[model samples]
Target: MKDKYDVVVVGAGPAGSITAMYAARGGCSVLLMEKDRDIGMPVRCGEAVGKDGLNGVIEIRPEWIAATINRFRLVAPDGAVVEPDIGGTGYVLERRVFDYDLAMAAVEAGADVVTKAYVNGLWKESVNGQERIVGVTYTWKGIPRKVRGAVIVGADGVESRVGKWAGIDTTTDFRDMECCAQMTLAGVHMEENACEFHFGSRWAPQGYLWVFPKRHGMVNVGVGISGMAAKTRKPMYILEEFIKERFPRAGVLTTVAGGVPCVDTLREIVKNNVVLVGDAARQVNPVSGGGIAGAMQAGKIAGEVIAGAVASGDMAELEDYPRRWEKLRGARNRTYYRMKKAVFNLSDETLNSIASSVLKLPREKQTIWGVFRTALVKRPSLILEMARTFGLKERE
Candidate 1:
């Protein structure tokens, strides 16, 4: 790699790769680094992404999709199921292939891509009594190397060290982190176009169980529980018990365990010459524990902002990153975080009653919000609090 570049992005996931692609396309010299030997090895995601969320970002390859989902089955504690048709379907992708393809796109766009390069920390320098990021020091092939840059982008995951090294507060509390365990199983009987979600404090306290079908009768069954629940019992233990009881005849293929940040956006994500994206910025959906779409969207914006700053030689232009992201995604994240807190605090009786009401609605209108509103309508105080918290009145 060169001694210096216009921009250096850590991590080669969707966010980092897209940032590199956009920056390079805008005519900035860019370098994208990944610690893993392979671009997408050791996958840790549920692998489901919305269709519209990825359309213009990257072209979808037929071989990368395991299944296309159009319908949802939301199951309550009492086994009450609400089926709904959600248009603009989603897909469970082969993340390994998908990640590599995204990185290749960045390389094709003129960014240099490197793997097995671990970033130890940010190289900081003081310019005129102010701290600024100058470059990164990392170990590659067991040798230390330094690359200087005018800008750095942290596209790292939830536990991002780059942000911390750059003085950005990237800490997430246990309550905001979702402990998850998933297993890909064969011989599982499931509908190809239907995704199942099981909700209950018993099944997955503070979170939910999901089943996304893959090709050839294989399915990815997973559960996410709040860190509080996980402290009492391991998330894998909860998942194992549920699977043994529900799918006694299924065969396991692969297992994965990881944490998902279900918190609101970080208080700050950009500083000086550096910016944070993807889970590093806590941009994942607070309710769904999904970050693919948010990461890609954030990467696109960060890329444009960084490119402008590099071209203009103005550090002030970099400050626009957080403002743009907040305008687009901050309110939704705040609303979802509140909704998650409320749902996790519900009693089993309340959940059952909500499920019954939800089942009474037509499939098209059977949403979690509908159930929440129906069950809590009698308590006008609670309704009003929710309305104010989510800015629902403005939406209405």
Candidate 2:
């Protein structure tokens, strides 16, 4: 690996790879490093990406998709189901293939890529008597090494040490941190190409349970419980119990356990010559817990901004990265965070009431806002938050 580059990005996930791709395309020497032995090994996500959002970041490839989801169901505590009148809007991805190709895209765009490189800390030096981040210290194959860069972008996961080292407040509130467990279950015979969200104390107390269909009959069954609720019973135990009750006959293929930081965007994402993207910057959608699109979007923005700043020799341009992110994606995440705060605290009875009310809507009125309206009826104070969250306008 080179000792120096114009842009040094840590992590080979969607955010880092995309950042390296765009930076290299913008005429910067970029290095994309992955801590894992291989990129996209041991997938951790629920693997659902919105159709338009994913397309906006990268051209959608058929091989990247595992299943086309055309239907969405919100299940209530009392077995009530509310179906939204949504068109084809989602896809469950084959992330193993998808992430590898994206990193390859970055390499094709002229970024150097490496694997099994673990970044330990940020290295800074005095420039004009002011300390500024200049590089990173990491180990490759157990050999210590450091790389210098004009800019360092941290695309690490939710527990981002780089961000913490850079002095960004990456701390998540106890309630905002979601403890999750997921399993790939086979021999399940429910609806195909349909994603279901199950809600209730029996499923996931403050968080929710999801059944996302994969390419085969295997379904991604998972449960996310709020940190507050996790204090009582662990997420894996809840998931195991739910599996026994819901899909008792299904065979378990794989299991994953992790934490998702559900906080909105950090107050600061860019500092000096150091930057944070993806989950490191808390870009995951609070309500849905999806981040592929948001990470790519942030990566692109950060890459362009850092490249422009380097090209112009004005480090001040780096600040534009966070502003653009806020305008393009962070504001939306903030709205979802507020919505999560409201919806996550609802009792099972309230959820059932909302679900029952939503199921009674006319076929034409069965939309996201339709369900929000039903929720607003029970909790009247959610009108403004709901309006902002759903982008609802004045009555026609």
lDDT by residue (1-396, candidate 1, tens digit) is: 788999999999999999999999988999999998989777888888889878767778998898898877888788888776765378988887888998998999999988999999998888899877899999998799989989999998977899899888898998778999998889987788888988888788888899888889888899998888888978898889988998888998889998899999898888888889999889999988989988998888899989999999998998888888888787788888987776676666767777787777776677646765676863455666676666567544
Candidate 1 lands at a TM-score of 0.93
Quote each prediction's TM-score. Answer: 0.93, 0.94
Q: What is the lDDT, from 0 to 100, of the residue 211 in candidate 2?
A: 92
Q: List clashing residue pairs in candidate 1.
A: none
lDDT values of the candidates? 0.86, 0.88
lDDT of 2: 0.88
Residue pairs of candidate 2 with colliding backbone atoms = none
Candidate 1, superposed: residue stretches over 4 Å from native = 126-130, 362-364, 367-369, 378-396
Q: Compared with the true structure, what per-residue lDDT tens digits does model 2 show for residues 1-396?
A: 688999999999999999999899999999998999989977888888888777667888999888888778889999998887457788998888999999999999999999999999888888899887889999999899899999989899887888889888888898888899999899888777789999889889889899999866888988988999999989899889889998999999889997889879999998878889999999999988888889999998998898899899888899999899999989988888988887887888888888878878787787778887789897775676566556676677
In angstroms, give how far residue 47 of model 2 lies from its true place. 0.6
Instruction: Give the range where candidate 2 is weakest over 10 consecutive residues by summed lDDT.
Output: 385-394
309 in model 2: Cα distance from truth in Å?
1.3
